[model samples]
Target: MTDETSARIAPPLTDLPIAVSERGFYSGFSKHVTIPSKIIISLLIVWAIAFPVNAGEVLGIANTTIIRLFSGWYVWLVGGFLVLSIILAALPASGKLRLGRAGDVPEFSRFSWFAMMFGAGLGIGMLTYSTGEPLSHLQNNPVIIAGEATALTENAVRSAYVYSFLHWGFSAWAIYALVGLAIGYVAYRRGLPLTIRSGLAPLLGHRLSGMSGHAVDIVAVVATILGISVTLGLGVEQFVQGLNRIGMGDWLLAKDNSASIPAIVLALMIIVGASTLSALSGVGKGIKWLSNLNLVLSFILFAAFLIAGSALFSLEIFARGLLDYVTALPALSFITNAPDGTTIGDGIAQWQLDWTVFYWAWWIAFAPFVGMFIARVSKGRTVREYILGVVIAPALMCFVWLSLVGGTAVELVLSGAGEGNIVGTVLSDQLYATIAALMDSGLAYAFSVLVVLLLLTYVITSADSAILVVNTINAGGNDSDHGRRHIMFWGVAIALVVGSLLLVGGLDAIRTAMIIGALPFSFVSALLAVAVVKAIWRDTIRLRHGIECTVPPEAKADPAS
Candidate 1:
């Protein structure tokens, strides 16, 4: 499984030595553990006990701490560090991040690869939140247009979509592209395995070699699991809530909090079972099919919403949304003010932080895993092409989706169609229901089912990707995908952990756990910035001392930064 051509040890990018043996151990584990079936069974058992017993005050403290310490400030910390990382990726030394030249196009078409990576990485969040959040924001936006103006107006509708775009668009994807460019360069070009700890490899040099590397791998494995689990937990809640709205009803909510354990276990089983199956299908066959299917279903749902809902009003809202979004982009970019009302002008500043900075932070906590997944599938593309695809491509898709779905929802409510009070009744429960309500017959019912399936598929795709990334961390990127048994082990284990935590705490509790998990990765991200910059600066000095650089950076490459 070794190739001399790919044998150059990825230049240690951290202050630690490359723990070759430790990495090899985890890599071996990844190659050996792939059992989808066992993963499900074990997930059920663990979920049975994680709840009922652990649901109490400690978790309460965790929730309060999360809101105070991480929730409010996360955007600033994550966003600030992200800008710093992008600047590092812009240097000529960043050419190292380039993978093998668009070498012999692979079997999958470029678009297919992009679809799988994109769907697996972020599609889950988009599907669950797109329609609902924008509507909610529109119902409340008074600060944007008239600067503390009246109630919801035409401009309020516009401002709503602007915030949705802010949450899902360019500012969000920037985190992924920047991280991918840094880690992918080391892995693809310099031959390092794809692992989060390696993001700091350039500065560490050979130091990542022993216990230190193991520490990095373990922390990454834990953080990634918690982070991905938070998303998966949310996915299960949304799916159940969506199903309930369609036909399933509230029994799924559990009679007693103790009964909630089985619900979580069942969800974990579905997620782990599907993902393990997809993982076994290998990255291309199973994952690609699922991802392509997800994209098609998503498009179909968008079409259904537009055609069935009020089209004209949606269009007007979309146009205005874009204008307000553009005008307010600078304000949302990074400004922050505490909600305490310390300064008169500070209230204005806090709005930007609440929306813009919060998203930026969410994406930062999100970028490591998503960036790794994107870079993993992005080989054999030019540096410029990769950055553009990863950043611009996804942002455009999100914007279009928001315009259609979010715009349609607001129009439906405003124009007095089915439910103007839809936001108050069940914003979380009915986003998908509204989609079904638009269509009039068995066809709508069928489409709703398809939406559920697609949601499940993307959920599995995301979990599978998370499983692989964690394995990579555990194995130190020994290059192999590990054994089916091993992969399944973690898959089930993660499902159990997520399900258990969900039972013990619920979505809010799991969210608190995630922000807690993010504390470490957030620091890792900061270190990644420092290491990348140090390496880039050192190489820049070396390059200057050597040949007269033929093409200036701005000329040879189109930098996203």
Candidate 2:
């Protein structure tokens, strides 16, 4: 059908540029998208296959060239934007603007809202990094490396948790919050397609319906896929580590190593299989239930650490780390640490390339999915509430989690309670091994079992939500019930991509892919920040002029073309 013809019959439930295809693999799949989006997806699929197939050459070149070049700038840009998000939230006028209509209240309860956001935002990353990151940092962070006398001194340990908080704190979530606020305000308040392109609509207006808009959506889609796949691959590796430590050790070790490609494949099969089922079961049922269960299990595991370990010490670490995180924010936010041979600046520069740059890229890559998902669930909240919930709540949770689990583990290792090299295991990406080392046989087995459960649930929450988000973008931003075929396609596609990258070069390959995907979206995120500011400024002016800024129902979508 022609564009105008389709518009005439198109349902108001969707703002898709074309009618929903009735004869496709999915019910709500878009029959029309800008040609540029199609070309971009095709190119990305080819790139995914080619780079992995020639990993040695392609990855080396990309890492030394594209990835390395952007790493330095990403740290500053991402940190600056995050600080900007806080300022925007602090503005008296902007804080009061609601995301939805004036009378609309939150759809989910407070607990459910936080649970879903937390589960989706951090997921298995928290499980993998909580203990591992602090231990890794304790052994060698910028502060400690700059001539600290003892590796496990209080100064070193405190610095460890501070970096942890910086990585997982307001800065990370602020990326997601900016994108979410932009998309939610433009899409809901302005009655536009609920897609990444719509986030730029305020800046571009109807021009967002052109090739420029297509490029934005395409970049978002590719970034979301790579970002989720990186997480999926990480989750799979940790899950395998936990499983092998529990019972499958000899079998996996007999193949190639504990983290053999075969082992990773087997892990993916199980995780992707369960995640696909959850995606098919739809959001309200499978995803919600699994997220809630993840939260409960996570609580139990974290509480066990807090109770069994140095509770007083952990609390002290948390309080002190929180202070350090705040005090150090200015330096931490924008310090690029340019190299100048054998100096603290040079060392910090390398560290930024390795950790801070990598994390900022990963978070930006993740922002499109997490941001969109947050926007979806955060329909009726005010800008301030949404920003605080996204930025503050999750960061606080991470501080407590890192301090308790990481603090306890660091104490054990430094005090010489454990024989295992926690730093070595973590650096080798076998963090579950460290977790096992920290507990007794019975407790270790229990911890492994709980971790596996949490892993599966967190992966499912992430994958299912990503499937929905990608399909939403694919179908031109209509988030109606997509066909099972489309959902399952993305599930399997993610599995294959993660598996392919793992086989080629493992985590390095995955990390490079994420960085590349994020490079483009970084520009998109900057535009989103600008669009949000413009939108809020306009809303502020309307309110000051005694005008109701909310769109009336009849104006949300037209019945006649």
Candidate 3:
């Protein structure tokens, strides 16, 4: 076919209409999405607050049942997402398709883009898990339980990193990348609203304009709230602990060393208040500034570990651990341990649930917030660039973090530098404990302050970015500024969810709620995988027929229209 003929036959990129309130409290918002999401989240908050013990018990039971029933599904779905992301990026036709019109240029600099992406996607997680995960896996993993390696020994270090890298590596980022790619392609190229349902446009077509679409977005909003709540909950624990370490007094923590209700309340107020203010400032200014600051702070922290805490050992671990992780990735990605009524089988099953399954759910739950944020900032990039930027680059950065920070913790335990203090402490305390072991009292306190500052930025960045994402979805993918009131509303709502759940059962309660919330979204994510592939396949056919795959500038529909 000739170019003119192909152009004539090319599909039109029409705007998908989404209802938004022009008046009332929800003015400029999609009442269909916003009202239901708010009601659902508000109900959960009231439940946790009114009946803390019962809320925790119900959440725990629901989490257990969901994990038992869907563990393999989570495993295979996540693994398949990774494979699908790679395939889409690797194909010549699909890889070259731009997210926006041919004349469009990227809005952010490469460095700024990466900074925001990493900060929103996994910055808090890197801080929370870098040391804790490696140390925990050092004590126990499936390989350790299987008797292939002994825990707390040199022989087990590889297995520790293998699992650590597994949880934090490519597979995790693949979930985020696929979600972003799907939504970005549909919204940018096809002129659809930049919401979760738009990602399935290729499969759902006009059905996305109705209640079915609202359901998809509601699932996304709930999952995003719960997902970010888990991060905030964990960060609050560490934030409170950091305060205690810096001489804030024993009143901040309970007899068990966990943050008390008062401490949790105080931390939430500070974090959510700051985050709401940042959200009002919008992404380009507040979010970008915080992301860059956190990246620099993260570099400084990593450098300290390199200089003071077993640099050579960490470098060795980086090299070997990365190799082991890469070599075992395929198997690790697909591995599912079903209970066979044997002790070992049950042990492995529980271990998988605690570690791998939980991490998958966490990442999946997190995908909508991070993915939408990424898609917003990542216009005008190719499929190949998007995948490489989103998946490969951050995964490499995570590996470096695991090597330097986590590796140092492992070295300390092996060499007796920590004298069991690091391993003996809670996950939130491990980072502080490691720093104390590495330096004198004064320097350690100074370093702990820096760590706390970094944590604060990460928490604010995640929370604020999430608030923007939720607003974006609620407004039916409207990227324009929502009034400050809406931003504050979400910030306060998220604080309530995190605070009430933390009061109920600490981080465990928050985690259980997040996992349960992530379940429905997991199925939605699976559909997203299929939708993206179908869209790309059809686009490739257009490319082969001499038709432009991207919507032309003049043909593109305005979402507001």
> Which candidate's TM-score is highest?
3
Best by lDDT: 3
Error at 235, model 1, angstroms:
1.8
Model 1, residue 110: displacement in angstroms? 2.6
Off by over 4 Å in 1: 1-27, 30-56, 70-73, 77-97, 101-108, 141-153, 245-250, 254-263, 341-361, 534-561
lDDT, candidate 3, at 17: 72
Q: Which RMSD values do the candidates have, in order? A: 7.2, 5.4, 2.5
Cα lDDT listed for each candidate = 0.62, 0.78, 0.90
Model 2 accuracy (lDDT, Cα): 0.78
Name the runs in model 2 displaced over 4 angstroms.
1-23, 31-53, 253-258, 426-431, 553-561
TM-score of each: 0.81, 0.91, 0.96
What does candidate 2's lDDT look like per residue over 133-188, in tens digits?
88878877888768863566666887888789999998999999999999988666
In order of lDDT, best first, we have 3, 2, 1
Rank order by TM-score, top first? 3, 2, 1
**Candidate 3 lDDT, tens digit per residue, 260-316?**
889989999999999999899999899999999999999999889888988888889
Alpha carbon lDDT of residue 259, candidate 3? 95
